[model samples]
Target: MSAVLDKPRAKAKPKAAKSALQTRLDAIFSNLKLGQEKLQLAHQSVEMTDPGEAAEVLLRTVIEDMLPASIAPMRREPLARADVDAAYTGMFPALAAMEGVIALSIGQVIEATLREAFAHLDAANAWMDFTEMGDVLPHREDITEADRSDNDLAARQPAAAETENVAGCIFDAYERTIEAFAILDSRVSDMNSGAAYGARSLVKVAVDATSAADETNTRDNCEHASCALHEAIEVLTLVTDEAPDLAAEGALALLVLAKQLLDDNVGALP
Candidate 1:
C-alpha cells in the first residue's frame, strides 16, 4: 500500500488542435449541410401550397418582403447611375437564390423524394396546352369553317398515349439521373482527379441535363427531352469510363432502362 501510494500518476495529454485548413473544411461542410436542410424546407413549403395559391403566397411572403428590404433604401434617395448599376448587380444574388430553390425542387422530384405523385402530374401538365394553337387567323366574323376546324385541331391537347410516352421517357431519365448523382455523391472524395476534374465536370453535365429535361418536359418539347436524356446517358458513360468502380450494376441497369425508353420515344412528337 505504501509503495502504491509512492507511485506518481501519469499526466493527461492535451488534445491536438485541428489545422486551419481542416477547420475551414469542417465549417464549409457544416454550412453545406445547413443549406441543404433549408432548401428542403423551402421545397416542402412550395409543395404544401396549392398551385393557384403559390403565386399569392410567394408574392406576399417572399417577394413583398424582399422588395421592401432591398428596394426601399434606394427609394429614400434619388439613385445615381452607379447606384442603379449596383442595385442591378445586387439583384443577381436574389435571382441566384430563386434558381437554387428551383433546382433543388427539380432535383428532389428526380430523386422521388416527395411522397405524392403530384410532381409527375405537374410534369404531365406540360403536354396540356391551354392557349390557342396555330397562327392567329385574321380576326374576322367571316372566318371560314375550315379555318375554325384547323384551329380546333391545332389547339387539341396531345394524344394521351403520346403524352404518356414522353412522360415515361422523362421519368426514366430522371430516375437514372438520381442514381448517377447517388454514385457520385458516394465517391465525392474522388470528384477531383489530381489535375483533371472529369468527375466534377460530368456531375455538372448531369445536373444541367436534368434541368434541361425538366424545362423541356414542361414545354412538351420531346426533341429537347430526348437530347437532354441522351446527354444524361452520356454522363453515365463518362462516369463509367472515369470511375468504373462507382458505376455499380444497379446504376448501369437503370442507365440501360433509360436508354431503351429514350430509343422507343425518340423522334416522336409531343
Candidate 2:
C-alpha cells in the first residue's frame, strides 16, 4: 500500500492545463485595455471650408459645450454697467480694422436686433396699458351710442407681431456676428453664454407670439406675447447680471454700430 501510494497512482495525469474557455478568457484579459496611454491633441485649425460655416460650428460649441459649471464665472454682484460700454467703445475700431465690412454688417444686424427687442418692450407696454383698464363700468354714453367702440389691445397685438420679424433677424445676427469673429481669427466664446440666453429669450417671444397669432385669435396672441416679453425681460436682466462688466459697453457699442448703419446723425439726452 505504501509503494502504491508513493507511485502516485501512476502519476494522476498532470491536472488538465485549463478549460478551453478559461484559456481564452485569460488570453483576452492579458490583452484587455483599461486606459489611454496619453491624451491626443485636437486639431488647431477650423474644419469647415467656409469661414461662416466655421463660425457657426464654433458658436454652437460655445452654446452647447459650456465650460464646466464648477469653473463658470457668471456673477451678479452689482458691477457697474459702464464697464460693458467701455469695452466695445474702443474695441470696435480695432475689430473694424481687422474684420472690415463683415464687422460693420454684424453691427448693423445687431442694431436691428436691438430695435426689434425694443419693439417687444413697446408691445409689452401696450399689453399692460390695455389690461390696466380693468373693470370700468359702462357709462350712460354706452346706451346712447350704437357703435362707439375702441379695439381692445389692438395696438398691443401688432407690437407682438413685430417680434416675429426681429426674432428672425436676431438669429441671423448671432450667426453673422460670430462669423465676423471667425474671420478675424478671434474667439467670441466669452460672449456666447449671455448672447445665447438673450437671443433665445427674444426668439421665444418671436416664435411663441407668431405661431399663436397665426393659429389663434388676437387675445390668445396677446397672452403669448406678454408671456414671451416677460421671459425676455428676465433674460435681459440675467444678461445684465452675468455681464455687468460688458453689458453697458456692449449696448453702447451696438448703439454706435446701429447709428452708423441706421443713420449718420447724433442726439443726446440733455
RMSD (Å) per prediction: 26.8, 27.1
lDDT of 2 by residue, 1-270 (tens): 688667755545677788553453243223111100000001112223233443233322222221111011111112112221232233333222212222222443333332332233223222222123333323323422332322224323543553445333333333323332232223224456746444444644444453543344344443454455445435544554665423322322222232121111111101
| Residues 1-270, model 1: lDDT tens digits | 799888998888988999653453354335333433443555455646533232222222223222223322222222223322343343332333233224324444322322222232222222122133222223323456775565445434333443466756666555555554454454445445531244434544655655566456653444454455456556555655665432222233344444444555655534
Model 1 Cα RMSD, 1 decimal: 26.8
After TM-score superposition, the amount by which residue 96's alpha carbon in candidate 1 deviates from its true location, in angstroms, is: 38
Best by lDDT: 1
Q: Write down the lDDT that model 2 would get.
A: 0.31
Quote the lDDT for 3 in model 1. Answer: 91
